[model samples]
Target: MTAIQPALDGTIPTTSSYAEWVDDVRPAFVTAARSGRRFTTYEIAKEHELPEPPNPRADWGNFAQSLVRDGLIEHVDFERSSRPTGERSAVSVWRGTPAARAGRVA
Candidate 1:
């Protein structure tokens, strides 16, 4: 596991609410996306110092869903590797919308 650190300059609150966590971590997410780099939810969580979800699968699912619903981010898919199983798994890549990129309302 990578050493994860909070992005905000202030202390991270003790709140357990996912929404709160998102809000706290939004700046980091935006910064990462602005760099034109793709990252997975695990990377986001680790980079932003979010608590590891009890169930990594469901937690990332809910987080992605919430981000889409809130219009804060979107996902992009690309082929990364090929294996004998003929199965492709997606890694979530976060991107801000046009309005967001423009620093305007979405």
Candidate 2:
């Protein structure tokens, strides 16, 4: 007779576990932002040494979104001009919070 298998249960894994990852990167982000410099998601990820998965789905973007949502960071929009001769497009800039700024001052 063949052995019977147990039924599988439904459960979902979380991506927010990466908040620690975000925290790890927060210092760098704060430092840069406090200097009045803006950072892109890619830049922050690289600075923090975050590992990317084979399949990309805005992990960094989500983290950034969360930061903005939680009032930790502010997003600034700017226009970027095309290379030699062309039009301009909107680009995003990030700014740190008061705490982050104070941390830098200290």
Candidate 3:
């Protein structure tokens, strides 16, 4: 009956709740489109202190993907920045779409 469960990273993946992530992320998305304050997915994830696997990603790409799918955000740029491994990496920057600025503060 002894079985190896997977090796557990057991780290929780996000710093905020789904709704909280939306709230935190929306403003950045709006700022990007309005002021050209470009940002990367990595930055966003890091800003929210997203942890590694097993626990569950707080929001992890889903929120952004949802926004993109709903026409709420769009990729506006890419940047090479430091990652956890101290390696510079290219990350996609996003901005709010016209649909998002429909007078709604999403």
Lowest summed lDDT window (length 10), candidate 1: 78-87
Cα lDDT tens digits for candidate 2, 1-54:
111222354221222456544544555655665666666655554554444422
> Please, what are the lDDT tens digits per residue for candidate 3 over residues 1-106?
1112323574433434566545544655555445434566666545544433223343446766876776767887777765666767676678667656564535
Q: Candidates sorted by lDDT, descending order?
A: 1, 3, 2
**For candidate 3, what is the total of clashing residue pairs?**
1
Best by TM-score: 1
Clashing pairs for model 1 are none
* lDDT accuracy of residue 103 in candidate 3: 40
Give the alpha carbon lDDT tens digit for every residue of 10-64 in model 1: 4333436666555555566566555556666656655566654445447667867
Judging by lDDT, tell me the better candidate of 1 and 2.
1
TM-scores for every predicted model? 0.54, 0.50, 0.50
The C-alpha stretches of model 3 lying farther than 4 A from their native spots are: 1-36, 44-59, 102-105
